[model samples]
Target: MTSTPDVIRGIVGVYHADGGLRGELAYLIGKARGTAHCGLCDVTHHALGRRREWRELVAALGVPVELVHLNERSPAVRAASEGRTPCVLAVTDAGHRPLLGPDELAEVDGDVARFATALRGAADRAGLRWAPDER
Candidate 1:
């Protein structure tokens, strides 16, 4: 793949858990019990809510980033990321391409700076370019 300016339309991050109130409670309890885990969640959220640095990073990238739970993924995202929760996908005209996997997300260790670096590096390697800084 080769880099093309503005080719990437958006980014989709898939969480390892399900959605809905019940799902949220389940995950919260499971997480506290050291059972459930979602690396992407670690990167984007905290006890209070979404991380400030994460929001800043998303704004700075100028790319629409949608975070979805396992049950909320679109069909294309589901096909591309089945059984691979906690991954990041680069959405383009061609389709959704895997940018970062679970292990890669885990390596960020909930640091927004590290996650940003990893995401940018992965997008570059995947030949995807951010849309002109819309923000």
Candidate 2:
């Protein structure tokens, strides 16, 4: 069976919003969902682990990592393409915009290096404080 790290290292795709690339990175923050939790303790631990991992990663990058929970019709998507808001450019601004159709969606399953680089760039632009691990 492939471990989560293995799976994250293999992902390669240019996810786009409104037909533009939004950079590439290992999207491994939410892959553990749906797995049966052994018990209440297990579930709590899993959630805590996820939060810790995310915090550590973001801190390492030294940036303000905003988790944008977009609904089906995401305003960020619209703002990015139309240049209506700066928040929307969070993932699509830099030079890493993906090249694809407006409706096409790519998935980055495991490409860790690319994901890290992209994330770093985003963090730099966003003026986030990097953690020790990110250095």
lDDT of each: 0.90, 0.29
- Residue 5, candidate 2: Cα error in Å is 35
RMSD of each: 2.8, 15.2
Top-scoring candidate (lDDT) = 1
Give one digit per residue, the lDDT tens place, for model 1 in 16-90: 999999999999999999999999999999999999998998888777999999999889999999988889999
Kindly list the per-residue Cα lDDT of model 2 for residues 85-114, writing each as its tens digit. 112133322221222222211122223333
Best by TM-score: 1
Clashing pairs in 1: none
lDDT of 1 at 94: 82
Q: TM-score for each prediction?
A: 0.92, 0.30
